[model samples]
Target: MIISQQLDTKTDHQVQAIPLDSIAQAQGTNIPFEVCVDHANFVRPNPQKHVNRLRSDNHYQGLSSQEILNLPPWKDDFFYFSYYAGLNGTGFMGFEAGLWSLSNSQSKSHDKCVDKFIENHRQDQRNPMTQLWIFNHKLKQIQWKNNKYIFILEYRGKGFQVINYRKTAWDLAQDQTVWFEFVDTKGNRLGGCTEGWTCPIRKK
Candidate 1:
């Protein structure tokens, strides 16, 4: 799903795993979540009451996580709704650039629009919400633009990230589908990919 257009001056965004502090510290604000849980807990017959915090946060992101994954709230997951001030207006991470690679669980990353960011709570390796995502598009959050990274995403463990070009961050009218996070109904979005409550959507 990674769009490999002719790399030119038009595309200046670099995919560097830099520290989130230097780029967004001055402008972007990282609003920490009061309640966070693993993606595994959100399964059917929810485990804890605190799970709602996770469910609702994802639901608030335009579309609920369970719904996004095609898992209805009744069977595949629980039903919940919530509001978090920290997640206000955080839009899609479909920065409009991506390279869909292959992984095990979901599907053929290449054929489908998914990144292979895997996780295992049982294993020491976990996919914590890395600032690398928000950092990659630091300019979006800092500049005095209406569409910028208002809030960071609430990803729990590491998973594959598609190639992010970040062109849409500058031009909203552009074809957002070029980005790997593009959902058929929601356009380019990363909100449903996680437990939500935060994403890099467009807003003033």
Candidate 2:
């Protein structure tokens, strides 16, 4: 059961359950989460393509942090969200600083898990999703992560806005199987989710 669903920023939270067997097939093999991130990044390069840029050229090398900051290139909205290396941070290492769009922001629940996973790397038990993040769109919020924190930036949308996000964790793994549920802020189950899934938080 392979689960293939899009997490569009426009869609409200909804758990669209698909068969585990199907998800496995679509995923090809039951690859570790880290491997999945590497492969996805390799194939797609930048999932968040519209809002970010990648700078790997040598002309940008040896500039001090201040000089790098002062460059006109840094002012571009796309530049702000994208990642750059020291004229040497090519490939994966260079683009690790991901910029979040609505889709990734909406997945903050998962981000908490991701933050923990990244930290766990020091403990030698890594969570694999950290590498899969890309800066597809510019976010209005302030995104920052330090050694122990994953901060959700603030953003303004139509009439509603996001001020900040605190780390929250949900247990989706049970009895060797993972469980997922999604609901709007009002607790309404979104019906268009993939098939065979149930929204655990839905209003009855």
lDDT of 2 by residue, 1-204 (tens): 111123434433323222112111111122122211111111212322312233232443555545544443222111110111222332222222222222344435334434443444445321112222222121222212121111121212111111112211121121232222232334343222211111111122
lDDT of every predicted structure (CA atoms): 0.24, 0.25
Q: In terms of TM-score, how similar is model 1 to the real structure?
A: 0.20
- Angstrom error of the Cα, residue 131, model 1: value is 5.5
The reply for model 2, stretches above 4 Å from the true place, is 1-29, 32-104, 107-113, 125-131, 134-204
Worst 10 residues of 1 by lDDT: 76-85
Question: Clashes in each model (backbone N, CA, C under 3 Å)?
Answer: 18, 13
Q: Please, what are the lDDT tens digits per residue for candidate 1 over residues 61-131?
A: 46444544342322111111121112122112221111111122212322232222112112312222221
